[model samples]
Each structure stands twice: as C-alpha cells, then as structure tokens.
Target: MSAVDVSLRRGEREILHGVDFAVRTGEIVALVGPNGAGKSTLLAAMSGDHPISGGRVEIDGRPLDRWSPIALARRRAVLPQQHSVGFPFTARQVVRMGRAAWARTPRQDDDDRIVAEALTTCDVEHLAERPFPSLSGGERARVALARVLAQDTETLLLDEPTAAMDLGHQEEIMQVVRARADDGHAVVVVLHDLGLAAAYADRICVLEQGHLVADGAPDDVLGEELLGRVYRYPVTIGRHPETDTALVLPRRPSRASSPSAQP
Candidate 1:
C-alpha cells in the first residue's frame, strides 16, 4: 500500500499534512511519534476509513476509491486503535465476523477452519468460548487481533495493537506482527512504545507535528540524539545483551546542586 502526498481534513482542521509513505510486501514499518503527531490519522487515511482532501492512497497501483469495497477488503485489513463489540459475542463468534468479506464465495466454506486457526495463532484459542466483554483488557486485545488475522488480508494496518497488554503479551503480539511481515505481508503499525518499535520494526518512520521527519532502519532513525530532540526527554539507546535488539530507555535527570555547594 502507498500513500502519496496524503492530506486529510475535518471541517477547517487538517489532520495530516501531505504525508507520503509506502510499505512493500514482507516489510514491517512502525510509525512512531509524540502524541497528536498524526500517526493514527495517517493510518485511518491509508485504510480508507477516512477521506483524503488531497493526494491519494493506492493499493496495487490503483486508487483506493476506485476499488470495490469487497475487493479491497480481501487485500487489506485494518485494526484500529479502539475495537468494540456491543453484543455479548463470544471470542469465536467475534473472530468469525472477520470472514464476512468472503460471504457467498467458495472461501466462505473455510470460515470455520480459518477462524480457529486465527484464534490459535493469536493465542486466544483458550478464550474462544468466553464472552468478549468478560475478558480482561489484554485478553480483549488478543481477541481483537485474532479477528484481524482471520480476515487473512495481505496488507495490515494496525493502530497501537499492544495497548492494554501485559509485558509478555506485548512481546508475543509484536512477535506475531513480525511473523506476519516475514510471511510476505505488508504490515504498518502505529507504536508509542519506542523500545518495542526498536526491537521489532524493520523500519521506523518518525513523525513530528504532522510531518514525516525521519524514515530509516530502527537503529538509524531511533538514535539517542533524535529521540531526545523529538520526545523532549533524555534517552539512551543500547543493544540488548542477548538478542542484540535495540533497547531504549529514558535517562534519569541529574540532581540539582544544593545552595551551599553553588558557586
């Protein structure tokens, strides 16, 4: 999927400012930035959920608006920042909804098998029979991801998928995301956790004030200097001792000198 010079507006307010981005198949691009930097807005535009006032979004070289809704659903799936189910739907039932796009097709017959596989892949098989509303936040997050995976689309746009998940679950979710990209899927995810982005993202796009400021490999784009400047806090970037993945941490502020010690 590619977004060229994309600009989105709501009334007189502009959310995204001519942002240009593309993610090739088999790539995982993490969008990282301070809050309100337009990361989610960009994802919404690329997913065709929000209209663009200028520029264009294309999938397979065709404009997003030109593709039929059902046809486009088969090529891309979006997991937004907030996922809600109003009814008392079980996890299995919720995931089965992902197959709605295939209704009336021969593939519809495979919905059961696909939903089960998606549940297991997302580590939510054990929660299959549980009511979605009864699950914890982390459990709900995993179930939501299972629903997305069941769609089985080639391109995925995820918005802060790890939100409300525990540390172990967060890592597990990111591992699942990376595995999908490795399987030749194009994955673009919004991430507030710089450490997680550094660890799992093949590429990082840094946005600041609705502008794409930096884009490159994780190590190159997530340098301590750049992070301190963008995030407005001292940070240190290091390599994990065992896996050698990028590790990011905030530096503690130094204590101010006492009046007696001052010159």
Candidate 2:
C-alpha cells in the first residue's frame, strides 16, 4: 500500500496546487515554511479534517474518502496545532480517548498498556491524573501528543507539535517522532524550526506563499539561493560542526538599487 496523496484548494485561493509528495515506510518528512504558506492546510487535508476543493487525498493507495471515519482514524493519527477541551477531563481520560478507534466494546487491558506507553513516550505520565485544562501549555501539548501516540496508527501527522514546548520537551518530542519513523511508521511533521527539521527530517519540503518551492533532501532543498528566494531574505547555509547537518542563518535583506544606479 502506498503512503498517501494529499492535495487541496479554495475558491480562487488554491492553497495547495497539486502538491505531489510521498512518504515511504519508516521515513520522517518535515514540511517547513513561513506563515500562510499552506503547511497547516496541507496537513488538514491529509488528516481528513478539511475537504479538498479540487484534488483528493489517498491512503495506502486508496482514496481517503473511501475509508470509513473509524477506519481512517485507525490507520492515521493526527496531532493538530491547537488542542483545547472545554469539558473538564482528566489527562488519563483524554489520553484513553485515542484508543476510541479500537474500542468496539469497552476499554481493554491492551488499551491501558498502550495508553501507559504513550504517556511515558510523551513524558506525561506524571500528569496523567491532572485535569487537561490545569496543565501548562507545554504539558498540555505533551498530553495531546500522548493521545495521538496512543492511537497507534501506521501514519502520524503533526502540525507544529513543538511550538509551545521548551527546549528539553522539544528534544523529547523530536526524539519520540524519530523513533516512530525508525519503527517503520510514515511520519509527517510541520516544523517552524528549520534547525530541528534539519536534525530529524529524512527529507525537507519547502513551501512559499502556498506553493511548494522545493522538495528534496536537506542538502539540496536548503541551499542559500533557494532559501533567499523563498523567504525573501539573505541567508547562509553551512554544515553543522557537531552533527554535520545543514545549518541556516538568516541575513539582512539585500537592498535593491535605484533605477539610475542600474549600471
């Protein structure tokens, strides 16, 4: 079964213009771009949360619309950029909800086991009994992630999962995501931190103003020239001394010469 094909559009907007990409088994693809670049829109379309105005989204070589809601939930898990629960629910209760895809009768011991593993994986075991609303932003983010992890789907889609996290928590989340990819799950993450993307992503997909400007390995996609064109700023790209990964540094925008100074 192929991973999936995700595309979307809006009236006259055309958020995603037939963006074609694939996620192989056991690979982590990071989608990076500036604001309003359609990163979140693409993720929404892929997760079945948003209707595609034109093209379709597929999973395992079949159209996503063909799968029943529960079937799709069982096959793919999504952690959105924002998660809020108005109803007061304990963290454990919320995390357990991820198992809803598999809960045909009642909560089984296997569900508890998976929830425990997910909580530990996301470092939220200590907060399992706390109310979801009482936890800090970072803690709540971790709990939200734990919920998705508990789903135990073959594919995971995350949108800015670490945006509200601390450095340590960010590392923890990235580590868990990388481990998931290593375990043969197709993982897609929308990351604002290019450094983190470079460190963890198997490939980087760059978007600019709702268009896919570049899609390739970090070395090729994150070149200085491409970065400058997409971001409209001067930038430098070099290899990290410690990790040998691509490092990007933004420079001041170059000034345009006046018409009279064209020579």
TM-score winner among the candidates?
1
Q: Which stretches of candidate 1 lie over 4 Å from their true place?
A: 254-263
Which 10 successive residues of model 2 have the least lDDT summed?
Answer: 1-10
RMSD vs true structure, all candidates: 2.7, 4.9
lDDT of 2 by residue, 2-50 (tens): 3233446676667777677677779999999888889899888888898
Question: What value does the lDDT take at residue 258 in candidate 1?
Answer: 54
Clashes of 1: 0
Model 1 over residues 60-156: C-alpha lDDT tens digits? 9999999999999999999988878899999999999899999999999999999999899889999999999999988888898999999989999
TM-score of each: 0.94, 0.91
Every candidate's lDDT: 0.92, 0.86
RMSD of 2: 4.9
The residue pairs found clashing in candidate 1 are none
